[model samples]
Target: MRSRSAPPTVRDVAARAGVSPGTVSKALNGTGQLRAATRDRVAAAAEELGFRPNHLAKSLLEGRTYTVGILTSDSFGRFTTPVMVGIEDALGAGRMSTLLCDGRGDPLRERHYVQELLNRRVDGLVVTGRRPDPRPSLGRLPIPVVYVLVQSDDPEDLSLTYDDVQGAALATEHLVASGRKRFAHVSGPERHWSTQRRREGVGRALEAADLPLAPELVLLGQWSEAWGRTAAAQLLRRDSGVDAVVCGSDQIARGVADGLREAGADVPGRVAVVGFDNWDVMVEAARPPLTTVDPNLTALGQHAATRLMDAIDGKELPRGVHRQPCDLVVRQSSV
Candidate 1:
């Protein structure tokens, strides 16, 4: 029934509620001191009038756009997608929108996107994946920046990353409890945080069991099936005594199992295999199923969003590297 010539505004809402525009603003922004009953009246009237605030005008007055920027590497990666979904859901609940920028592992492209987001006046920023160190000057930006699934050079910067250390520990401990003592590791890139944490976790478990890892038993390479094949081949050829294998990822574990089968090794009979990143699609179809750790990336993303919102709300957050817990799923591969 309303005319299309002019859309409803704060003034319209105020007029409908029998209050001043200032009172309407206070109730909507939750800033100025306003009685709860009066605020409810203003909100109800605004809803009835179908009044949506002029975001640009409100931002101009408050010097904030209430927008958050999310920077991700390889936006289509399986692991990154769930985390992003969590961020989106949390931000939406907070009544904020996100601008996503995919770096695709390009430093120059990342820098450009950061600059663009800043120019658009995003109130906060969240960067994902391992990036070339953010420019030292990024600290000077007026908005808060948080890192997810990656480590940043700035110690003070907020980061929520996968607890790879705990993930590795759980995998290794499971193998040990399954009565497999002789162990080997098929690892990813040496410089990767995941690879490093996994290695450390394995070592801790071994140390706790009063066992020492043989240098030849540790196979370090990339997060690829090809590397898994090569590492599995060499490991079996050199030491046929290994009773278990801990793979850096589900992909790597698949290749390792394939190679072991070709070499006539009885999976879970003579050797148990455990991997990281349950990576459900590939894992569900893997032969003999895979015992792997679930990084809980979705939960990690949600946590990051919650943390960022807390910071925005001026709430005291216990700041440090927060590592989300990982779950070890049992399956045929390690049975």
Candidate 2:
């Protein structure tokens, strides 16, 4: 019998089962070809004793921690939240755990978290971000690293992200297919990588359709409902003939809808509105839901996690950026 304060051990289970410690060990591990009856007895004894195997010991013996660290700039950001869920899904399927650290977009804080994770000897690391820009690399580490939702400055590192350009193109094409010839684009800050890519995508689609996204028709501003309202109003004032407006985000789309309604323009009948980031809150809440682009961010996280696991398992890790495709969600706004 073990002490009341101490956890039951293999020896205790062996004693309770009337078997040798070595036999108990073999039976517990399903090794040594023990008789079925003896194995059953050992297992029953272990269960009665509430004996829990030490996973840390097993991991040490196997030369693996079976744990990975997730380092993110914005831990609770809308985009990163879904990505983290996808990562957890993949890691759970593999019976692995995660240590999450938020950097809050501060370089010093990020460096501190990285050091802490490394100190804990995480098997691998997943670096994620709030935006899809090239982030500073964590430099060389002893273990494999994977970047999610953003690529590292180092081209040799592995990264998984969505195709922003294609996403925008999909939105623009949807509007064009709806017989909307006159188009206007309103999006977030001009300096954002995603904004630039989305703008380029809309332009490319318009060019392919032999349509023009004239200078006055493009409005690059803050990513807010207020900006959306202001931009939509200005767009309408400048070109009341605009048949469709493509917004950079769902929030912006909501504002644009309000602007159009205020201007006595019928949504989808007189001015179709499309948005990016199929965010449920803004899309579903709008008077007449929104048609938006789904970036498949969760899938990107899953891919990144699986790729990191593969590297941990001694599989060859591919280098450079890997892009996942985005899909469109059709709703009343676009139709």
Candidate 3:
């Protein structure tokens, strides 16, 4: 047995794997070709001996800092938290560390953080915004970049956002399956691209089911519960015979549920309510658990990290926006 005073080294791992130090180095660094069995044996031997590579030497040899940076305009808010976790998970497997910078939507602060990250020599960057709207790119930088949960307006930069149209279409399809005919949409600001896409989705689904497009029943409001409550009241006042309502977010859905119940409508019976972004806190707390569309934010981040890593490795990837699919979660609100 080796003494606790000394750490296991590559030489020890090579001895156990029955390979020379040169071969061990190649196997660990993933450099020269080696038989799969030899690589597996060396890996197992290293794991058993608790052998770790000399990162300093590895960095010197590979000319990489083995670190990545994520810059978000949200200041690490709720929406960006899971994305960061996913990024870390993917980068860690590649022996890379992560650095996160929050701009809080300040242009000066964003520039400052960008410079800071560059000074630290991160291998690449991942950029995101609070919303799915497109924002100006970070311009051509020395490192590669991938955008997630948001997009860079520049056509040359790689960007990713959820398929809002598909998500909303699924939500509407569920409501239709539940026997809802007359429908209303309560969503965020009319200016938001997400809201516009969701509205289009709802319209398309309604058309597909041979249902009325009831554009008059749709209400454009803030992305908050207050707007939801107000819109619900307005919807009831119209006496439009609306049997189903689709919302842009869980917050709005929760408020709509409250308003409708207070105004004497049977949730999921007299009316079905479906929401987007299946946010747990707002959804679960709603009178009936809110059925919602999940954006799979973590998965989006994971894919973004993979794209950035590929770019760093000199792989050619297509630029422009890539749409990630979303899922609809059913609950009492939309059963």
- Candidates in order have lDDT scores of 0.82, 0.91, 0.89
User: Which candidate leads the pack in TM-score?
Assistant: 3
Count of backbone clashes, every candidate in sequence: 0, 0, 0
Top lDDT hit? 2
Per-residue lDDT of candidate 1, residues 74-111 (tens digit): 56667668888889889988788999898887778888
- Over 74-108, each residue of candidate 3 has an lDDT whose tens digit, in order, gives 86477898888788888878878988888887878
Tell me the TM-score of each prediction against the true structure: 0.83, 0.88, 0.92
Q: Model 2, poorest ten-residue lDDT window?
A: 71-80
As for TM-score, the candidate ahead, 2 or 3, is 3
lDDT of 2 by residue, 1-335 (tens): 54699999888898999999889878977779889999999999999999997878878888888889999887658888999999999998988899989998889998898889888988999999888999989888889999999889998898889998999999999998989999999999989998999999999999999998989999999888889889889998999899999899998999999888888889989999998998899999996899999998888888889999999989988989888899999999989
Clashing residue pairs, backbone N/CA/C < 3 A, model 1:
none
| Model 3 poorest ten-residue lDDT run | 75-84
